[model samples]
Target: MERNTTRRWARLGAVLGTGALLVGVLAGCSGAAPGADSGSTDTDAALKEDVTLTWWTWSDTTQEQADAISKAYPNVTFDVVKLENPDAVVTKLQNAIKAGKGAPDIVPVEYQTLPQLTLGDALADLAPYGLDEYEDAFTASTWNSVNVQDQLVAMPSDSGPMVMIYNKALYEKAGITEAPTTWDEFAVASAAIHAADPEAYIANSGDAGFFTSMIWASGGQPFKTDGENITIDLQDEGTKKFSDFWGARLEAGELSGLSTWSDEWTKALTQDKLGTLLMGSWMISGMDDYGPAGRFQVAPMPTWDGEPASAENGGSGLAVTSQSENKAAAAGILKYLADGEGRALLNQNGFPSTIADLENPEWLDHPYESYGGQPANQIGAASSASVIPGWQYLPYQGYANNVFSDSVGKALGSGGDLNEALVEWQDTLVQFGNEQGFTVNK
Candidate 1:
């Protein structure tokens, strides 16, 4: 909303060095250097010497991606460690950096975790790796999510742009001609769908996090600050209004109060029990597993009856840890992953790429027959362009999630009184921000 480019740059510069590094010291005994592998893709053979680049990633990569990387870059050996627990990754990373041993070269970081890693100084600044040159190739929002303080600390691999996915059959059954474009319309349309089918409603009505994501889409920031001071905005009128609307719907028995991001919700989605879902682009893969192929379609997220509106859901970025011995090599690896070809490779491996890889007509445009014969890949890519960027991802974003989750649980668990729980959550957030030395004003 702020169009003052020069002022925004100035603000970025001011906060770039605001946080102090927690700890950063590369560990472990002497390891193999870069280009040590020689023979096959095996570590021993590829490096010739013993070159092991430790990589910590949250989830498993596709076999196709692994095979391609192995074949293309046989000289570098990667000790890829898959993590089932994400918090453990951060904990282990911090401990390794502090102890000066067994530190990983690359780590997959969620957008929300940027502050945690960067504040600790465990991650490397990626500017030297030609980040500037490839910056324009990525979606503006995706690229800016990882580029904080004018420092490109990480390369964005994938992002979750909020999307409105609906069951065309359900909507038609409900006699709803068009998808809702505003919150009021969304509510009215949802009520009509429920009236018609008794089971139709928007996505899960029980999840407050889902509501928070929607609130943000309406141009409401979770927290607002004047650089030196922060304030909790959860109890603001905007949030309360959303809570009331969503809560009322649940209480009216017009919606299923299932948890968003849960298997139950997925079942509801696949079975077409819900009318529409405010989901992310990455959610497409699960559709094939849950719903019959080609059953749903995507529309823009319903607005807040206000200004330009959209909210990002989930995404991961690639960050080079300071512990990496081969920074250049690591950067090179990222360069391959973030650019057009690299993005395409990521898409091939199940990760959404911001770069338009469907430019070639020969490439499969319509990969799925489901969804009433729609070109999903192209539609999903076009949605990426509408996402708003340059928002602040505070260091204590995890705390914010905690606050939201607890508030929601309390509201649902205690007779649906969101206001009381929100007041408490707001206070907790203020305390957290202050304790972290972030500005928190009353």
Candidate 2:
């Protein structure tokens, strides 16, 4: 299973320099003819050029968004190709890059998968497109997630700042007056809820993404990557803290081990068999679809200390493929989708990553009928701002997620020691990373 580390690093080094010319032009360091605005002129010319960009996306691009992008760049048209899911897009994009052809001009890459793609040099550096100016446009965590090493390979599109969505009715029934602000309070609330109704628990701990996010929010540095080197430490203090706290609850039957997003989980959600859900702000958009309107309410995620802390659950970035024949045009489309008018349109489906959208008075104050007319965006904004920084995902996060059920998940229902499970998970990741030619340190 050994890979060519030397070749991969060489390719990445070359990719890092791909945007130097554009970077120089954008920085006004490119010596052009007097009174000649090279950066703007080049961008205008590229936008005005007749080009049809193919986009590979798992999420649907609204007709309004398409029309807006078209109006912005009349010369550019899109052939949107919808894939089944994000994983499918990743597989196809990887294959296309290896084949040196047949890749789309644009793709939506999940934040976790960006590292692997960048290491493989499959994406173009977007610094030349003046995207570097957008550093302040996004939340710090969201912005940092899209930057691999020094290269800006993608633009932050949507983000999933963690929040706790609870059933207000269920909480009231359990005699819990307010949402828990600390993990200690959460434990008490969990006991209260389970005692009130034997069938309902405070939350579920049977999801890999949820576990990873919990560890992140607890300030765990489970994974860190630098070029071909990686660090995997699943038994960090944060990891043990989360595992010990939740593991006790699982053993005491105060928490459910129902798998998230499964039919059974969905049934529990709709039937009010679950009291709270600690997930991302994106879940708010689908609250009504999950249960009766006004039943779910948003709250900041409970913290280890009685202070603000959060982590990202899910999100994606828009990137241009290196295999594209029309890189400039493709980059323009990405900008529109991520930073321009299309951003607002895209926000209709998910929580926004940009500061402008997050802080906009209208958006922040907008109340959701599904959330009992509460201004839930305020909670989402606060959580996004409070996300504990420096969380890093492994390059092979998809595989890590897939193997979680077998390792850490084995301890969930059985109430076994999660710290031991995490050690097993760490060993598995270390071996996988070494096999992939990475200098894995556990």
Candidate 3:
């Protein structure tokens, strides 16, 4: 185990060397101040290292996660710094690297931002870190979020597979017979529900992020590449199909606009005022907290127009920063989290596992009685395999997503034109790419 660990860190060092800035960024990775080791004894055993590793992440339960860390690695100590906004993590990491102090050994990078992190040389390649050992443990596709230039940088953490959670009791009351499988069927069912109850309709948010998910699931790519210019293709067949379908539904007054992922929206879910929520695997975890038990049921996301596919929503990966003096120790902890008993614990605590393990069946067995005994983890396991694959990680990912959000929002807004909005977004992405030192094609 020690020999293997050495080889992994050596390989990891070589990869970090490719990015010039990382050399300076990682210069001050050693020195950790000793603390009283206050978390879980179990995690402390798993790490078993005589060093402390700092982790920068986003989570509601820092103490619980820290406890779990201690439980997994008894010898290794972890100092977790929690930050909420996804963008803040990148900013903080970059600042730490620049300051040459207080940098984390391991960091959690969202899948959407993988490309940007890799391009900037802000993260270390984790290939030598026993990635091969844990590769097969994760669902095949979700595991690649951190793969850039063929080097694996992150361990699969959680995934968001698209699902439609509905109010079964509400459907019964409205005399609606079936859950929607396609856009057409969804519209029909939504109309029936609306007619039965004047306040009900399918839920929609005029948000571009949600639209991007729908566009991909509907068999369309948002930006087409010509050498390097990301041209707007939102007016393509897939976009038109999605916009026309949803627009028609809205115009028919069979829909109610609710802000996305907010407390008010969750309240509507409990009230059964919304017919369906097109969300990801993590939705199941929120159900118990938001709605009463036995009121809802889970179904596959409504299809756009083909063999049903889901848009990849939320997922996280573990990246070992180049600056960590203890790369081997970091890798050991990541491997345990991705493959050992840690993955199962993450799944049970509301973070769906991206890694496949023997513990999978055990996790799935604890059904959510709130969704009428729905085996959501089981469903997520299957759905993870079918996610539409091309969420191409971009070097300027944060800028691109912002552009996508803006363009899609404009297109979906009342009187918004899809073509004009997309053109503007595409132009913005090109400008940002060039400014970030990347070659942008015209």
Leading candidate by TM-score: 2
Candidate 3: regions farther than 4 A off: 1-49, 98-101, 223-232, 253-255, 403-405, 411-415
Model 1: runs farther than 4 Å from truth? Answer: 1-50, 62-64, 85-88, 98-100, 197-200, 206-209, 224-229, 235-241, 306-308, 350-353, 358-367, 413-415
* TM-score, one value per model: 0.79, 0.88, 0.81
For each candidate, the alpha-carbon lDDT, in order, equals 0.66, 0.84, 0.69
Query: What's the lDDT for residue 362 in model 2?
Result: 96
Candidate 2 ranges with C-alpha deviation above 4 Å: 1-41, 62-64
| Tens-place lDDT digits, model 3, residues 100-132 | 555688898877777766655666667755566
Q: What lDDT is obtained when candidate 1 is compared to the true structure?
A: 0.66
Q: How many collisions per candidate?
A: 18, 0, 22
Worst 10 residues of 3 by lDDT: 30-39
Question: Judged by lDDT, which candidate is best?
Answer: 2
Total residue pair clashes for candidate 3:
22
Question: Could you give the candidate ranking by TM-score, starting with the highest?
Answer: 2, 3, 1
lDDT of 2: 0.84
Model 1: per-residue Cα lDDT at residue 290: 57
- Give the worst 10-residue stretch by lDDT in candidate 1: 22-31
The weakest ten consecutive residues by lDDT in model 2 span 30-39
Per-prediction RMSD in angstroms? 13.2, 10.1, 11.4
